[model samples]
Target: MADIHITIHNKTFATATEPTIADFTLSLVSGEFVCLVGASGCGKTTLLNIIADLDYDYDGDIVVGQQHKSPKIGYIFQNPRLLPWRTVRENIELALPDDYAGDVVDNLLDIMQLTPHQHVYADRLSLGMGRRVSIIRAFAVNPELLLMDEPFVSLDPPTARQVRALLLQLWQQRPHTVLFVTHDLREAITLADKLIFLSANPMQIISEVLVAIPRNERNNELAVENFRQQLLNEHPDIKQLL
Candidate 1:
């Protein structure tokens, strides 16, 4: 399986002398869905940016598949960053290799349930529809690693729940390694195979929780409620923040 190892001996911003993510080390195996939960200003987004190669000033060793091979890494942000001038299909196609565009775009549109609105421009779609399009666009290139930063934060609870289900279904189907960052504890528990808890400010991993429950059993009402309560009791700070 493909693997990613992130080792941060020390990382401090130029503006601030304090280290943001210190001694942060973790390995993510291919096809595993891991969630990182933390309070605000905990460097969650900063860490993601480093992983995505958007921030290079940090001091650390981030090794993916033994070497940096320009592997495709897809990122889905809180807002759907679709080009307003592009159609849903066009947006998804933009992520595909030029030679594979036509076939890949159609497949993604169907997979994302956007076939009916494939020709619709970004501005014409609803928020949920636009988010779906964004997801499809990210997955179209068959990324080795998928990084998400509170992708469902703006949605209502019910909508977020639906999106969570959709994400799980898609993960099962495509099986890409995922590193999701969120402030929502339930969201982290509901979707992650492994959970990494980060402490407030100058964030560092405080705990790693392995989820033993089968993915198929995650949504079972009784099991979910019981697990939720257990997590709440175990992590009082997290519960209090929520």
Candidate 2:
């Protein structure tokens, strides 16, 4: 039923199923932007760690279909995590693999309008700028799968919105398979191609709701509100989580 299919089953020592994610199955089409939303303590970060193989105890099957070569992974954490002493461009350079394209960082910087700040030290930039640089670092390596763990959670609403728009622009330029985790319904609605809801404790996927509203159309506040209402109406269970 999906192009990018994954199955997970975990037997934890602590007998905790919520953050440990006992039983779960989810799938998505290639190049899809998937948002994983759940309650505050519902294993969202745990699940992402499993996906990145940072957690090894779990047993799961992951199929990414066929590709010419093994896919590289890019992970964006809650903080920008850029080295304080490194320049913005230097931070990106550090992430570049031997096979990285020459113009990759420059192209990313140009579109994010971060070229002017490329020479600035990581600590010198604003929070929003730091987040953008983190994003660029992820893309610089041309990763096949991008895992974002609430990269914009710390920013103010306005700053978060701006980063989201910039993220959209980057995604459109070269679509990468992205798994973004967030607790905010509005942010999830703004970014996701499909929504994955999870149960409270065990963190099993309760539903997969497609956001059919066109991305361009979702720019308007009223349109987003209307579409959200439609989502709530069709999938009333989401109301509780929201």
Candidate 3:
């Protein structure tokens, strides 16, 4: 299998000539975690939509690296998107592929420390817990490529930290390819091995920085703070929180 490559010539709004994302290209090796960042309304979600095949009007090439002719892709949006009537386990189970036969849902719940809540209705779950179910639902497909669009956006600091830990634990166990988008620089620094920055509206990638810290060291407050400092030192404009 070759590396996953996405080449976007342009994406538009009213007409083909009025472009949003123009000439953006990204490549991902198997099991790598990459994060995308940009100013709001810069078409980051639109780019993700194109990759997930939810939008097809743009001119681009999405080349998959896996041996399967069609790769399995799962997405977790800003909202949980769970069925209020369904149980936590049932919510995740619904995303499993038809041929799947293993205890995937049970295992994901176990690792996320959510097994006890398995039988509860989705509507009854706390915000953090509900988000965990959304994550489990995405991983239930055992996706070859996972796309996340600021899934941690609205959570409180403590809850967001816990959820991030759960996500890292799952990634460590399964090691699937990941493409995540976020507005928070610290969040990106905490999770991504590669960080991509996009320009304001004609959305184009302006810079890419590789995080050199070991994955295991990323969660330490001191280490993360130091790395965060380094990012600020290197890109003072990032301090503006664009």
Q: Each candidate: what lDDT?
A: 0.81, 0.82, 0.85
The parts of candidate 1 lying over 4 Å away from their true place are: 68-71, 237-242
The clash number for model 3 is 0
Can you tell me which runs of candidate 3 are displaced by over 4 Å? 15-17, 66-70, 237-241
**lDDT by residue for model 2 over 31-120, one digit each (tens)?**
899999888877888777776777777766666664322235789999999999999999999987667675878899998989999999
Q: Write down the TM-score of every candidate.
A: 0.93, 0.92, 0.93
Q: Write the per-residue lDDT of candidate 1 for residues 1-242, one digit (tens) a residue.
A: 48888887777888887888888888898788999988777888998888888888877887778885434689998899999999888787777777875766676667667789999999998888888888887887788888999898888888788778877877787788999998887787789999888885467777788876788888875776778688768877665344
The residue pairs that clash in candidate 2, if any, are: 18-201
Superposed on all Cα atoms, model 1 deviates from the true structure by an RMSD in Å of 1.8
The per-candidate count of clashes, in order, stands at 0, 1, 0
User: How many Å off is the CA of 89 in candidate 3?
Assistant: 1.0
Give the per-residue lDDT digits (tens) of candidate 3, residues 27-107: 888888999987778789998888888888887788786442335688999999999999998888888766776577778
